[model samples]
Target chain A: MHIEVVANIGEARSDDLLHKTVIVVDVLRATSTIITALANGCKAIVPVETVMKAKEQVQEGDLLGGERYCKKIPGFDFGNSPLEYTREAVQGKRIILTTTNGTRGIQKSMKADHILAGALLNGRACAQAAIALKKDTVILCAGTQDVFSFEDGICAGLILEELTYTLGEKNVLINDFGLAMRGSYLHSKDRLFETLVSCANGKKMSRSGFHDDLILCAKSNIMDQVPIWEHDQMILLPRSLARSTF
Target chain B: MHIEVVANIGEARSDDLLHKTVIVVDVLRATSTIITALANGCKAIVPVETVMKAKEQVQEGDLLGGERYCKKIPGFDFGNSPLEYTREAVQGKRIILTTTNGTRGIQKSMKADHILAGALLNGRACAQAAIALKKDTVILCAGTQDVFSFEDGICAGLILEELTYTLGEKNVLINDFGLAMRGSYLHSKDRLFETLVSCANGKKMSRSGFHDDLILCAKSNIMDQVPIWEHDQMILLPRSLARSTF
Candidate 1:
């Protein structure tokens, strides 16, 4: 199987992603937030690319949660921080989410056969979940603004590493992007925390005194959830319910 | 000083390249051919993205050259091989060229204050030329058909390494794309020939019986030519003439 990774969602074509497994990553911290909300028993996440789109999705049972420039949007229930996704607040509620990059990446991949949200927080599980699908994969990084972001690229590399290492025997193939991300992951693996803190998004968070968000984003393989896209929203299936279609 | 490396030209906006120095690389053939043609004393080369556009630029003194897929077009003077650009035929002649990706990259950066072609052949000279200008630089890799091309990324990385190392005292800053290329270059530097032969483009050229072109492309830093974009064409100025504009 061939794996392609687009550093930006702008490079993705709907036709190419059609019927293929697409994984969207925004490490600090859209995907992290989605997986956290789902793992904590949130009903579903409706990922919209823009704040206006999120506002349009408001309902009595839906919580508006996301960020614009790393700040919680006015009237939103939560920002992009995973720490804000505690069970007490989000349990059994639908979430309408919008962020600078990650949601855009997801909306771009709406044609994907199986769309999943991934991050450094749930990297190993996310990789394994994609591999189990047995379909060609496209890993899209949701960069900050329209430009490439540091933490996201490294997170993409981590997933690529898992996919390549675990499924090497299957003779999986990767293009330049996949190879590039693998190299990025290898280069930054030893100093992931330091690397994240030095990137633009991290500096933005740190400058705004969001040290806890950085620490949470740095923790790897701690969350075993994979937010699978279905019916216009993302919901994590319990491990027992994750076999065919979540 | 700041250096931004767009993984491919598709990600670059014209406004972003406006009044900035742009360096474009297509290591597989287009830029390599341009560098080779200029190094061999060709008067000027016009790089066009499409075959029909190259046909439109035909003139009494200009020779048309380029490729469709790794092979020469039906009625072109020569295919996009550095070997075909030898002094005996192309010396003192203008070459109007079209290729799959590299020319598109050049045309996209037409609004730049200073634009130049770069490749593995003249990597160091190209990087040094950009560094001497002391302007913020954008290294655009002419990836294959809007996708990440392996050799181009490595060539970009080599340029980044040179720029960072030479201007160490100036505190050169690189973003995620820059760091990714640097890592990619370091990963493939030791085995450039092997690396080139294994990439998708390399394999296509090899399968089509262009082993010689692959070897030429794999050889780095042999040519000292820098084809600076001037007046809608690329021409190389001698070392004495290169200080300000080449």
Candidate 2:
């Protein structure tokens, strides 16, 4: 199957994603945070476009997790940093999350037949799940602040590289942005951590005193669960769950 | 100066380009066509967003040049191939152009203080003109059919590479998309011609019998002229004219 990449959230529309397997990458923290929440036993994650919508969606017991411009909203239970998603904090609870860029991508991609939350943390699982879905795919990179961001592009390339490695014999066509991203990833895969740390978003996060979050995002495939989207909610799916899933 | 790359026309609005210098790349043909028209002694080029507007703008001597889907539109004098713009045909004539994607990008970028039509044909010249203007720049890639195209991204990266080589110490910050593009260019620059012929757009053009257009587009620095936008029209700027252009 062919793979098309929407380089930023701006290029994606709900209609275009319909009937396709869409993998959303926001590597700086949003998807990473989701994976962390899932691995730590969070029940389910609901991603909304804005903080107000996030607040409205949260139930009495469900925690609100999100950030606006990288700062935690005044009353939210957590910011977007993955390091803050401790088992004691999120375990066995549901979370309604929003972030500056990533949530916007998820909100726009809700129409996809299958939506996968992908990050460097659970990249392998995400890749395999996408391949297992066996449909035309779209990799949507949620750029920082409505503009292109390097960290997300690197993660997108990593995913494409993974897919190419496992499914090389398949007929796949990566659009230009996808090709460029894969090229960037191949060039920096050896120094993935340092490269992410030096990219524009990485520097912004570091300067904003979020070095730990950067470290957490740079760790490759540390988590094995793939966060799969069904009916607008994302929950980590094991191979068994995804295989049985449509 | 910061380098922001709007990967496709969909991501751009004229207001965002206001007071900034915008470099537009449509390597598969539109910008390449503009560069060829200017290089062949065309007096001026007016880029319009629609076929109806192009028809209205064309006078008896003013040629209509553009494409709809890699084929020449009915009644248009040209089909966006650089080879069609021979000195004998385009010399001293004015051309009104409209294409599916490139013209849209130009219309969206009109508010910029400086708008340049750039492509692989005159990549070095376009990059030099951007530096000479000394303004915050955005590389607007006119993607194929409102989606990312590899040839345009490669051309954008080539211009960025040219700028980096000549102005190595300048205060430059390339956005993530720009970095990824530059990386792709470095990887494929050695195989420039072969790579272009093998790219998605190139294959489409070749299959449609536009292989000659691809060859014309692959040559670098064929002409030293840069097409600079001013007063709602594009004029080929010589070094002497540009030096005094304010």
Best by lDDT: 1
Off by over 4 Å in 1: A40-64, A67-77, A86-100, A240-246, B48-64, B68-77, B87-93, B240-246
lDDT of 2 by residue, A137-219 (tens): 89898987667777788888888887888778256777767777877777777777787776788888889999888878988
Candidate 2, A85: how far from true, in Å? 3.3
Please report the TM-score between candidate 1 and the true structure: 0.86
lDDT of 1 at A222: 82
True contacts kept of 2: 0.61
Tens-digit lDDT track for model 1 on A86-119? 9999999999988757777877888888999989
Off by over 4 Å in 2: A41-43, A46-78, A86-100, A198-200, A230-233, A241-246, B48-78, B93-100, B194-200, B230-232, B241-246
Q: Write the per-residue lDDT of candidate 2 for residues B1-35, one digit (tens) a residue.
A: 77777778877777889899899898888788888
Give the winner by TM-score.
Answer: 1
Model 2, TM vs. native: 0.85
Model 1 lDDT tens row, B1-246? 788888777777889998788999998888889989988889999988788888898899889998775678998989988899999989999999887677788889988888888888787887778866768899998887777787888888888887887779248878778877787787677788888877788888899998999899887778778898888899984575444222
Pairs of residues at least 3 apart in sequence or in different chains that clash in candidate 1: none
Quote the lDDT for A154 in model 1: 83
i-RMSD of all predictions: 1.7, 1.6
